[model samples]
Target: MLDRIDATSITTIQLYNQPFIRAFEMTPSLPTFVPATQLPLAIDNGRLVLQDMLGVGAYGSVYRAIDTQTHQTYAVKSLNKAGLNSRQCAFQNHEAQLHAKVSGHPNIVTLHKVVEENDCLYMVLDCGMEGDLFYTITERGGFVGNTMAIKTIFSQIASAVLHCHSRGVYHRDLKPENIIMFGRSVKLVDFGLATTEPVSSEFGCGSTFYLSPECQGGFIESVKSYDSAANDVWSLGIILINLTFGRNPWKQACPRDETFSAYAQHNDFLQTILPMSTELNEIVKGAFCLNPKKRITLSELARRVQACRFFTTPEFPSEASVVSAATAASQASFSTTMSGVYPTSNLHGPDDKEDSGVDLQSMA
Candidate 1:
């Protein structure tokens, strides 16, 4: 039976599921404060004329706004004051801090400035208009291309992940939605689920299907004791499988909550996802290894992806195909060269590896 939901009742739905208009209701009324050092923005002419709203989630709404002075487009993510006032403020603040710390990386979305309007926090980032990789791939007809194309796209994603890891940032939510593509390039977005250090206790931060086994266990207060980076690698592997097969690894599995656990314990689960390609199969298996220690690192994964045989394939004639072909060839070369230098076996095991070398203090 279709429930007769009214305008007032619509706001009760989760932000991700609600329409933009209904979700906008969740945004707190703007606060009045003089433009200060950290907060330099105002509702100029009574409207925040942004290019468009890219996405809205429990955390906030992401909009493409232009800097009038510089005339530069930027992604402005505004935190929902209601959610902030609730218990989620700490997580939101933590995410903002993480973005602030890793703001300058090319692969990572650049954070322009932070603003507080009406007690709500806003993060302005350099805008990328091409939308997310997930939507792009779906629009082009699921999983369209040769092995080389897959290798190239995966390598670009791996490079971004490597950048995050080098800085001790683990993108707990590594999926197509979070991967934005502009022209031929890709950038990682949505830091709401990212963390500088592992959550030792048991709190899960990512989407259900993409989350790692460890994250599904429970809530962990301390970030220093978990293998967050390794978890990110696992999610990346799942994403790779999805891209190659045009569907999730465990799409048919019952009870979505148990999917990760099932994948972690069974080799058949790995085998099931392998027919995509011998090379990509091995890469996914290594990344999805239940033992975090045994799983592949982003650096090694990047190398493996780059060196895959698919990269040697002939280029497609179309301009899009040509760009994809170039990206694949470049990544394949890098991966092959890197594999020789780092070697897959040298990666850290789940128990042996400590925190990533980067400091979390600044990110906090």
Candidate 2:
């Protein structure tokens, strides 16, 4: 008789190798590009011409291209024809259509058009030349400590999420990698995992680490089973922590047996970042609550952040200042803020309204 491997030993092995396993496990499979025949659009002198490949995903590759006719740059996302053939193309098409519908918001990446060419579906969006927040944070050596600057960025993201929620669009994936920053402005990109209806499956689409607790437990069971806008808020909270700490809060949590529920309830894990500001700590705790109902909504979170000790003071020089003084002050302020000046101001107008008509509704 052959010797049997002990289950307990296996568990211990998995726990010890959890980090490596998670890295491999969360990585999506490579996409299979559709045959050229499925591509319906032709590249001409005055049409679309592929510039460069930006990234690849389980669906397909994203290409940076130029529209010769309009002389405009765009990010063309091509869906793998092979995947489309096996899976539901309707959902992909729906995602593109929904993005097109709400592409007007400043904080949301604008979708120019969609064209089918050679068995591939190509979606054109404004190309962000400044790259994504992930790149910025990485290049800057982790977290940037400009409180006003960070709040400014978060406001833009919050505004986009709120707008999406109001329009019944749920962005299942919200992370720093999906947040593109151009100069001082930021926009939310990628809607591959977005839905206009309620998300019904507990183990639905999302990056593993960013997946909400409810989602990890496989609690979602129906198409209308989504947790409203709070899910996005939770992801945003995680993103905030990442930006603030320069790492994932659950980076040490093993993926094999440490489900999101267990991770959320562990107070020891929560206490790991006790050095963070009380405001930020509270924000993080409130957003990552195990119960979706307990998590604060995007509107409420935005208000809290805006009213926090950040975003109150003026950093840049005003337009009314004289040319020489304004230029000097602007340069100084920019340098100081960029170097890490945490301002404390309640950046709220007299009205202090919650939803300024920006929607964050789910598309599924």
Candidate 3:
């Protein structure tokens, strides 16, 4: 089941502002997500040439590849049938389904196509060359005085998560490792643990450090179900804390854990462990409520993110975006009461030239 077709030199696409919302209205959702074990051999797309191995994981490896004709780079993730169990295979299938369902989201990595080869499933994805948010945290040693940077990254994640939920896809695993960087822009990747339905007791899947309290195995006696959407939000909160503080606040998300325990007790941990901006502080506070029902919904979280007074007020992409040329550029900012530092408006944008002026909104 392999077909090779000549492709044109398709430029790497970048979306900015609200226009990105409807950019892929015609992109079709995939019809099937069959397991690799059942696929025919040599399901490769010969039109794309593989280069270096980008990453290795439990399920498979990702390679940097380029289209032969277009020469555009893509990430090819190979999921071998041997690396997955029946349940894992099913989850993998669901992951492929969910990703195709939300194909054009700017903050979520794009999947160009799927191929099966040598009993392996390959997902061609966006090449995030800057690596992941986790690497940046280690390099920067925390956001430090850059509150605007913190807001921008967190808001992008929040908006993406909310968008997925709205489309009925629950990204059960959301962590720094899963958030890959595309220059100043970030895209959520590795949807191997994602699903279109709620996570049942049968599967409590996520990295321990970023897992929600309800998803913890030891936290509950019998296997139980969880609202994976909340887990996504909770993990995003942890990611925010990690970015702000430069380390894991707690060993785990359990009440018995030191940091989480303190959070459970009058929310002291948030204030005690890390010093952050007021807006970030409140976002973290709402995320660690321990009660899934009370935890801030993604919609509300997004609103709270956009409402930060630090945001100067988003503006249109000005004259540059409207040009017939290949790219568009736009930005806006207002005076801030806090010293000379001004946080640029909007959640996703180009990298800040300096701490004094941070423009987090996207540039077309």
lDDT of 1 by residue, 287-321 (tens): 76756778788788778877876422132224235
Candidate 3 all-Cα RMSD: 17.0
Question: Per-residue lDDT for 336 in model 2?
Answer: 28
TM-score each candidate. Answer: 0.66, 0.69, 0.69
Which parts of model 3 are misplaced by more than 4 Å? 1-45, 82-89, 140-142, 217-223, 277-279, 309-364
Stretches of candidate 2 exceeding 4 Å from the true structure: 1-46, 141-143, 218-226, 252-274, 310-364
Better of 1 and 2 by lDDT: 2
TM-score, prediction 1 = 0.66
Clashing pairs in model 3, backbone N/Cα/C closer than 3 A: 348-360, 348-361, 348-362, 349-360, 349-361, 349-362
The residue-by-residue lDDT of candidate 2 on 1-364, one tens digit each, is 1223333232222332232211221121111244445443444333987755555544566666677777787777777555454446776687787787678999998988788766677777877765556544444333344566667778898999888888888887787667776556778877866777655454535665566756655332223344846678878887775555344555322233332324444533333322355566677777877567778778888888877773211321231122334334422433222211100011112332221110001100
| Higher-ranked by lDDT: 1 or 3 | 3
Candidate 2: what lDDT?
0.56
In order, candidate lDDTs are 0.53, 0.56, 0.56
Against the true structure, candidate 3 has what lDDT?
Answer: 0.56
